[model samples]
Target chain A: MLYREAGQFKTTYAADMAVFPIRQDRIALALLVAVAFIAVPFMAEAQVWPFRTDYMVRAILIPFLILSLAAVGVNILIGYCGQISLGSGAFMAIGAYSAYKFATGVHIPLAWLGTAISIPPLPGLISIPLGGLMAALVGILFGIPSLRIKGLYLAVATLAAQFFFDWVFIRVKWFVNYNSSGSVSAPDMYLGPIHINTPVERYLLCLSAVVIFATLAKNLVRGNIGRQWMAIRDMDIAAELMGIRPLYAKLSAFAVSSFIVGVAGALFAFMYLGAWEPLAFDINRSFQLLFMVIIGGLGSILGCFLGAAFILILPIMLDQIPHAVGIPVSVETVSHLVFIVTGGLICYLLIVEPRGFARLWGIAKEKLRLWPFPY
Target chain B: MVEFGQFLEILIGGLLSGVLYSLVALGFVLIFKASGVFNFAQGAMVLLAGLALVRSLDFLVARGIPMPVAILMGLMFAGLVMALTAWLIERFVLGPLVNQDGLTLFMSTIGATFILEGAAQMIFGSDVYPLPLFPTDAWFLFESAFPGGILVNKLDVWGGLIAAILVAGLALFFQRTKTGRALRAVADDHAAAQSVGIPISWIWFVVWLVAGLVALVAATVWGTKLGVQFSITFLALKALPVLIIGGFTSVPGAIVGGLIVGAGEKLAEAYLGPQIGGGIEYWFAYVLALAVLLVRPQGLFGERIIERI
Candidate 1:
């Protein structure tokens, strides 16, 4: 069988500890990367069957990749660290608005105090990570509560951050650069001399960013810090007794998770929406990301992508299904049905398979290893 | 003097609306106490119940039924609908998900919430339905002492009165009834209660039923106040702070928490809105709850949590 590891034995410790320990997994990953990087773009350029319209790439793939990246970040905190955060939208907003501030620059004049301060604009690429760093700083600040509150209470507490940041971005005109309409547009994105304007260009940009972040996240989770997070998640007291400081583990999880999520937010605003208000990163965004982590496998890197794809594709499929079948249903009815089916599916997943699609993939892999062997 | 009266008026108004919050929070406390599931769908339940009641009332009135009889029939129909919903949720959702971690259970309830919200909209129509069960007029008090008296809404007073009656009735039920004793026993320890011949699933169904009926009462009041619509689901968001401040496990804690949240947010909005950009109430209750959580993680009335490793 293709998945059988009978002839593949790791003689070195580094080889054994590699993220993709099995040969089949590494090959599969390479094939996947090839498809994402080369084939997809080639198809989009050639205007192939599914890629005839840029809508698929622009609308679906771009948001999917961005949300998947955000889910990876959220997975680090909730799935990896065992801290439930319903305030991820707040962190995303922080990343986005801060990135916007850094990219466009800001001028704050204290006329009453007879002083003024101004920030010079940074490049778009530079500001995205800077936005992430700002989110990390705020993530650390908010994560202080996790030391005391635990479980559902902590989840509810995180909403304070969501609502607070939402208010901050909406009410404080300084953040929005005093736009009377209270909406901000993405700054011009230039990678050296190349402009990321076209849908294909934007898709590739997001894809590459996702690749780097996903790889980094995978490596992080397999490292010592990830173990610390898992330990804290599994049993904080026991982990503490074992010399893993809950403070360090929890805060670092927040920092790393928020940083990734923040970067994703910047990408989402700049690449996807192009123009957005505070409503772009509201509580529902947090829930949507959380749902991705839930439906995807909790602790698996691959699960994030799987969950994001499934959650994103579901509504589209539901929308198309009725029309495809020639059923005359109102848009409202279809939307209501979408909610019902989504809710029903979530319940079903929780009840039947709490581990989600990742577990299903795992089961398939296990089966593959024994294919053609009867025993 | 006029400012003082205005302040009292705001305070009184806040306290009364806080009573309505308590009514919603009460449903959450009931389910959490009995089944360890934080029912996020309570707001949706309120919406569904209100919709059912209002729609039924409209139907009966259109058929030439008397006003009083129509009201009675609508209440009964809504109660039946709630009871059916309780049974279905317990059978399909909560029953299978028993003994899951609190977070998983909580998330599942949210899933349930989406289903209920969608189903309610589909069945009852998504448009807002007005329930004029109570007078919406305001009463002026102490006009002799002050040039302009404090204004109090009649609806809020009715809400407070109903909440008091509901609490008293619940207390009596818990104190005097066999089923109530069984419920308390189950809340104490699930395994032990099961060992002593209590049907855990049946108890869960009953608890959900009780919570459903409570949602009905809340919907009747809230629907009358705000008009039943999709926005009622958001009341779940507002009630969360109340649950946190009051402690998740205590009924009286819910009432007190609701009062604090209502008064605190209203006071902050009125006094602080001008200085700030307004809409402070949106996060004010949550911030207060967070502060409480920091000082007393178990909340004001929640039982002390003892973790074992």
Candidate 2:
């Protein structure tokens, strides 16, 4: 009965169009945000029961938040626009390396023509979004093929971007600032004078970014452009006939998606990994994010978070379960089992509910609205 | 003259290596043509088949079984394993997933890839097992034309011959066999074929089995060349560009696509890699495929895509 929206009345168009039009949903969202921002950090600081160790905050939460951000990006393109991409990893790499370049200071020596240009290092906060912008630019370039290619063919075509970027980052010394070993470490990150040093600060940063990006994504999808994307996805020929320019709809999806994923990549490299090589953003990373989008629910903002948590936490949980239960399994065996279980779960989920966890959540909510009663 | 000979050598080498890719691509073409599911698990299947064959062969050899008999038994064992895998996949994964969109099926096959890769490695042991079935030596041609004759690998020649035979056999099968007609019928229209009393599940199973056996043949050459290991799965990635270039549906398209990709990448790497940063071979074929896609979205030999509202 509490879950029912019976008492909620929209007095204005703005109220009706609000993302959380249901009073309960709005309250729940506020509570979640508050818990994330205040309670979780405070708990970690105070060493509360579940937060007794920083491992949860450092290892699990940070990666989960960052990856969820990336999944949100992938979902926009694949889920909303209906263009399949297997090159999200390459976009991530581009974001990361470009951010690294901007953060460290770019030096361009026109030695062949006897001129030199250099950019002084920018702050970490500025470089992160800049990295996303850079990724967006490249994403649009790679997405050009989608105009001609569709479906599985388009997906395979995106691999060109993945492999090409992989080679660029590995072969070009400039991207890494000519580091002797070719791996680059994150420069000290600062917001004005505040150093984002601790896991709590990193977690908060990711939380805020995710909130902002997700809201923006939600609004975009609910607006005219999102409709255009959905139209194109549902039927491109009909969409085109209705004056939805496939070029604008498809490319904009790429641009926005890559921008968000790029920010996630920057955060991932700077916050989670700290020190990384090109290999950190390999094709497997692409697959991982895709899995998150798929398992979470396509075309749903809430699904990104659900999917990310499921994909990221499942392996860790699986690893811990056998150990906690006193089963002596080798690390190799556990890893293999993780693969088998993950694969099996993907198949199972696709067969049972192709829309993913978000749909399941929706079903549960509908049931809740009818709790303690029946027709 | 020396440079020309070297260029010819590289071209020949690339084309031969491309044949190995074609063998793997053949598996993809078979499954895709019949079932319309792009089998991302093709490379993993190759790995599984190779591991099964090599592991069993080693076991039989260590037990003092005669060499020829052991090879025969090992092939049979691997064939049996592939048959079982085909049944499991068709019955469990693809059967329930019937009538779903192609993308979902594609994603499920990817899931199947992960499962096969993990299970094969876990069961058969993940260590690289060498299959030294082919001779690995070099031959020189046109000795009088250049300072040294154009170099060619003996193994590559064997691979070319095997690929030609495999393609010929597949052609004969498709053209002459009753099952081949059924497969074509199913590929043309699944619903119509079903209505005509064709067993869709059985046809899918046979296609997958044929694909699996083709993977066995590929694994034999590739395992002998590079040794069977986890890295063999990367061949699936390599074959994708070939698939797109050749067209997803055509077998002959696969061979031609492989040749173009192989020769083009090797040529680019040799001629342009040094000028750039090298390792362009990794992306060359894909970029070539992208270029082809721009020109012919259906692929060079692929059927023209006709979209409906």
Candidate 3:
């Protein structure tokens, strides 16, 4: 009854064009954001809740948020642009290492008359986007092939990028700040008086970063540029005939997509792994992000989070399922089961509905709208 | 100079290893030609083949079966497993997705890859299993003017011969058989073949069977060379650059591409690796393929793609 939009009528074009035109959807979204930002943290502080501070902050929420960010980033490139990239991990690595370098290597000397001013070493806010920018530059460079190649060949080209980046980062010591051992530490991150040192601060930082990037991605995909991308994706020849510049649309998609993915990588390094080497952002990372985009739903924004949550959280839940039921299975066996389940689900979902879990959610809502009587 | 002799040795060894690359690429070409699915599960299929053979052999041997009987039975059992895998793939994956787009089909195969990889690992734990069937004692030494003479493993020579025989047998099977002609017809036009009473489904089944057998042979040979483990799956990826360079559809292309990539990788790693902190073998083939692609996107022997308006 609450979902029936019967009493509401859009008086303006802006109202009709709103993202959540249904009042119930808007309310639900607001409630969700409020719960994520406020209620979760509040519950973490309470002594009674199952939301233990250490487990919630360190294990589940932080990784979930960062991966969701990556899913969004991958979705923008593969989903919106209609370009398939197996090098998203390479872009992520670029973001991470670049951010690491900026955080540690930069020292700005501010001069004002007789006084020498210094802003204490590395700030997380600036370094993250700087990392994104670096990734965007690299992304555009690698994206040069989409101009000449299409489909399966383009995929191989992207794989080339993955292998190339893997080689460059590991072989070139400069990316690692020339540390004797390749893995190096993230610098002390500070935003004025508040030090982002603890798990809660790191979680909050990642949460905010995810929210900002997601909103940015959402708007980018909804706008004119996003239309151009979908046009190229659906049919490049037709898109070009209609006066859409393939070069501009394709490159912009690469840049914007890489920027968000880059930010996610930065957060992944800064918040989650803390001190990650090049190996952390290998080909498997690319596959994980690609699977998220695919399994979530290719063309929906909400699909990103849905896909990320399913892929990231499902294995953990799968392990706990056998334990909770007292099946007495080993961890290795459980892990293997998890893999089989994941693979089986992917095939099943693709066969039934190639659009993914997000489309299934849409169908559920559609069914809810028509629930009282058979159509 | 010793360098020239060493270079010649590297070329020969690379060619030998290139046989493995060709074997793997052959699996891809056979499937892709029949169905446009670009089988990502080829690697997983290879792993399964290795596990299937070893596990079957062990299971039979413990029952007091003679060595030759056990070996023959194990090979037959391995073939049976591949057939079962092919049937499962056809029924569960390709059957349901008859008219789906290439991307969806590709992704589904990737799903199949994960399932097969997990299943194989689950059945036979992730330890490396070596099938020491090939001769390991004899070393062929080129006693040229090199300070350190070039040493060649006898197993590699035998491996090459076996691979050559397999390829020759496949070529003859394709050229001389009616089923092969029907397969080519199906590949040429699925709807056309169907209209003319060719069972497209059976053709697909046969194609997959052949591909699986090819994977089995490749995996067993590779296992003999190195060992059968999760890492053996990576050899399939090594075949990818070979496909890129040779052309995805051409049999001859796969062989030539494998040889070129093998030699290029070994030469690059051997000569220039020390200057670049080593490990050039990992990405060298991919980089080489990418460079070649920029010049000729159709690959060396791949059919030229025609984009229609």
Candidate 4:
């Protein structure tokens, strides 16, 4: 009775076409935002979850947010666009390295109509999107083959991007600013008087960025472009016959996906790992993001968040479970167990619920309205 | 400028490494041809098999077993582990998700890859194990025969020879054997083969087992050269360009693709590395393969992909 949408009639087309048409959804979203903005920051860091910064905010939420952003990007390409990419990590790395460069080395002199002007270097806040644009350009360049190759063959072709970017970052000193050690520290993120240095600040910054991107992603999918993407994904020839240009849809999907992914990469680097080497964004990172999108719920925006939470929090929970039971588990044993459990769970999810957690949640909601009735 | 002899040495050396890459790619082709599941776990299988082999060898030698006997026993243990892996995959991963889409199956294999990698590391401990090099004294002598002092590792020559024999053996098996013909049929049409009295799951099990065994042989050869370690699993990415250039389903294509990739990579590194600050070998094969793919969407040796409305 509490969850019912009864008597909530839509009076206009604008109200009916709303993202959250139900009044209850708007309230829930407001409460969620309120809790995230207010309650969490006030709570001190502790070993226990929910109130614990170490467990909840730092270890779990930060990575979850960053990965969710990346998952959204992957979801757009693989889920919405019908393009299977194995090089999400490559795009991420490009965004991160480019952002790092922009934050550090973008102070240049512009000669405009015989007048010389020195351009001030932008801060990390501005550099992140610039990094994303670079990745978008690169993503579109690599996406040229999608016109010809589809499915698994297209997936393999994308690996060329991953390996190529990886080599460039690792071997070329210019990308890493000639850091001989190959490990680069993320530039400080500053905006006037505000300094995003603390974990809370970092969490807020990442959360806001992810929320903005997630909103943009949802809006994009709900629009005509999203229809075009689904058209191509379902059947490119059919979509093309329907007057939806395959090249435009496919390339736009790549651009949008890579842009979000690139931003996520910058956040992943600067926010999560303070100092990172090229090895962090290897092929495994791409696989991890793909797994997130797959298990979260393909093509759903909420699925990205859900998938990221499930994947990132799983190992941490597994690590702590033995200790909670007063049995000391070796780190290596825990690591191995995490992998086996994770792999086993993925197979189970694919077999039993290939639609993933989002669909399951939808089913649950449907069942909830039926009350005490037995299906 | 590099001497003509030096160029020949690089070319020969590259061809040898390419042959090794073909062994890995051949394993992939076998499984892909039979099941249409591009088994991503092939590299993890190699790592697991190598770990089993080397660990078993260590166990035998520690107990004062003779060298030849220990080696044979280690090989047997590795084979046994591979067989067990095939059974596990058949039972859990493939059987339950039989009619899923291609991407779902591929993703499942990725899960399988992680589980195997973790389990292997847990069992064997993630330390690199070096094997005694197989004797190729004649190859060493030939290296000395070349001018400009370009040295070739004798073991690499033997690796190439073994790889050639492996390809020939596989070709014969596919040509002459009933199971091989069944695998080919399954590759051609799964439902038709199942209706025609070919057991699809059984064929899948055999393909995975055969692929696992191929992985084992490759691990032995590669472990001897590079010392079986974590990086070997990533070498699967290296073999990818070979698979792309040649074709995913063809054995001879893998071999030819490997030769082109291997030779091309080495030549680029030698001739163009100085201009690019070196290490061009890493991405050169992929770029070359991508260029080729642009010209022919169907790989050089792959069957033409036909799309119908």
Judging by lDDT against the true structure, name the best candidate.
2
Evaluate every candidate with DockQ and list the scores. Answer: 0.69, 0.69, 0.60, 0.61
Ranking by DockQ: 1, 2, 4, 3
- What RMSD value applies to candidate 4? 2.8
TM-score of candidate 1 to 2 decimals? 0.98
Model 2 chain A: worst 10 consecutive residues (lDDT sum): A366-375
Residue pairs in steric clash, candidate 3?
A: none
Q: Clashing residue pairs, candidate 4?
A: none
| Candidate 4 local Cα displacement, residue A22, angstroms | 3.3
Q: Please write out the lDDT profile of model 1 over residues A1-375, one tens digit for every residue.
A: 767888888999999988889998889989999999999999999999799999999999999999999999999999999999999999999999999999998677889989988889999999999999999999998899999888888898889899999999999998998899999999989999998899999999999999999999999999999999999999999999999989899999999999999999999999999999999999889988888898887888889999999989988887888789998778788778867877787788899988789999999888989998948
Clashes of 2: 0
What is the fnat of model 4 with respect to the true interface contacts? 0.58
Please report, as a residue range, the 10-residue window in candidate 4 chain A with the lowest summed lDDT.
Answer: A44-53
RMSD of each: 1.5, 1.5, 3.6, 2.8
Each candidate's interface RMSD (Å, one decimal) is 1.6, 1.5, 1.7, 2.0
Q: In model 4, where do residues sit more than 4 Å from their true spots?
A: A44-56, A107-119, B136-138, B141-145, B148-150
Against the reference, the lDDT scores of all candidates come to: 0.91, 0.92, 0.83, 0.86
Show where candidate 1 strays beyond 4 Å: A108-117
